[model samples]
Target: MRRYLLCTVLFFTMISCVVNRTVVAKPILFDAEREQLTLEYMRDRYGLETSSSAIDPKMIVLHWTVIPTMEESYKAFYEAKLPNWRPDLENVSGLNVSSQFLIDQDGTIYQLLPETTMARHVIGLNHCAIGVENVGGGEGLPLTRKQLKSNVWLVKYLKEKYDIDYVIGHYEYTNFEGHELWLEKDSAYRTVKTDPGEHFMKKVRKATRKLEFKLVPEK
Candidate 1:
């Protein structure tokens, strides 16, 4: 009787671990300066009105920072306004664009902003998606295997924590047209974007599958 009871307890514990559930880690908070800047920039650039109510993130969007270092990426996103070079950013910021997370080439993941907050990484979907930006993917510094591995781990971690329904690359976001999560300002607001390309997304999705997470279709 004692042995049967012990086995039953262990079995239920294992079952509980396998169930799909939302588990959130305490979000790493941004400094007051960056936090204020991001909030203002989102309002000015996208005309988005954010609130504590915007915490139900349903997707994870991946990006590559053609820039060299994480610090440079941080500075770009740290400003209160969008920069001029990216005329596309005229509405987003005068300093630099921002994402919720920044992953370095070495696979170091930095939480630039809170997970529950909105990031300006994607046009219409930023309100409901979490963005993860990688350090380098430009002319010389191609994305590395380490970066890929890190992304896979990060995606799995997020899936286990959120009621996430989809994992997508920044390039594929446009295909989700008319979906409930799609939110853009106007037809002209749509612009072509290809970052952290197809091969990378494939690897991440493959890794995520091993953990029993579902991939959103490439529409």
Candidate 2:
């Protein structure tokens, strides 16, 4: 009985270590009305069924918030209901853009929205891509190594949970514009993106190469 107890204790210690390695903050759920807007956007923009707000996500697009501080970034997202002064996006959803996840410079991860739910982070590919936004990438506030490591952890977690097909930086999303993945209604509504730089993408792809994501065909 003592030997069996020892084995059980060791087993639980390993499980505890595994969970500690990939620490994530509890999600702050959005109100029903905001989620409803996401559902309506998916249907109206992509002509998808409204049975659920969860998207049939196939890709993961990484981003960086140009906003300098974490506090300001959270406030911006928390306060805004509709996108301000963006006339083109108003027709798409009129909703201020958000991501499924956001990471702080110190490597803390937070779920801003449900994993499968669509948030308007990327154009043309929002219907099929999940966005992961990092809290810094501005001139004064660059991304950190901690953020990169945490991203790898989070991406691995997501891969195990979903059939994730492609992982790309926000800039690379345009490469899929002509592919079947592109589903935006207004052709001219596209915006250029450079968030989550090439170096960051290279690091993530290298760490996650075993996941076997599909290539974004050349334009």
Candidate 3:
């Protein structure tokens, strides 16, 4: 009887650890419109022949939204349609880009969309990647330690929840090309980025090294 009691107590303790973490889920722009946007992004940009928005995430891609304030960052991704400002991306995807989660400068984490659903933040790997966008990484506005800690916690939480195989920075996404996960049809289509930069990624990797996520595969 004592052994059974101890096991029950241990189970609740584990649940507490996960439940105690603060993840503010403020869903924005999720509906039939947003769902269609996801579908369009997959079909047009990736040449994926899927008509539905379902996704089985296998990787987590990190990014830094250069849009400084949390409100502006939220607004940028809250739209279901892409704005006309990105003429360079017109030929690629007509749908607005978005991420599943956004981490504020103060370390607050907001769920912009369902974690497993596709977010159009990374190139080539969107089909299998869940994107997490950090709020700021512009000139003189470096990422914060609080954000780092939150990312570590979030990654661990997600690993426990999903069959996550890799955690990569946006810049490292190209490395996944030619690997089994690479799904983009147009080999020439690619975007260059330095977001959630080298130093920031180094810290996240050090914090999450024990998680055993796959390193980006070589071509």
Which residue pairs collide, candidate 3?
Answer: 82-96
Tens digits of per-residue lDDT for model 1, 1-219: 999999999999966744532322223334565456656655654465663324478899999988999777777776545655678657544434677788888766777777777666887777688999888885677888978877876787777788888888889888877777765646667778778888888888887876664555556
Q: Compare candidates 2 and 3 on TM-score and give the better one.
A: 3
Error of 2 at 186 (Å): 0.9
Point out the higher-scoring one by lDDT: 2 or 3: 3
lDDT of 3 at 218: 67
- TM, every model: 0.74, 0.84, 0.87
Candidate 1 Cα outliers beyond 4 Å, as residue runs: 1-53, 92-96, 211-219
* Clash pairs detected, candidate 2: none
lDDT of 1 at 90: 70
Candidate maximizing TM-score: 3
Q: Estimate, for each residue in 9-92, the C-alpha lDDT of model 2 and write its tens digit.
A: 999997685478754554443677777777777776677767677778888999999887777666656633664645666765
**After superposition, which runs of candidate 3 have C-alpha atoms over 4 Å from their true positions?**
1-19
Model 2 misplaced regions, further than 4 Å: 1-19, 26-29, 83-88
Candidate 3 — what's its lDDT?
0.85
Residue range 40-121, candidate 3, lDDT tens digits? 7788767777877768889988899987889999998887777777768767766678899999999999998888788888
Candidate 1: the clashing residue pairs are 45-91, 81-93, 81-94, 81-95, 82-93, 82-94, 82-95, 83-94, 83-95, 124-183
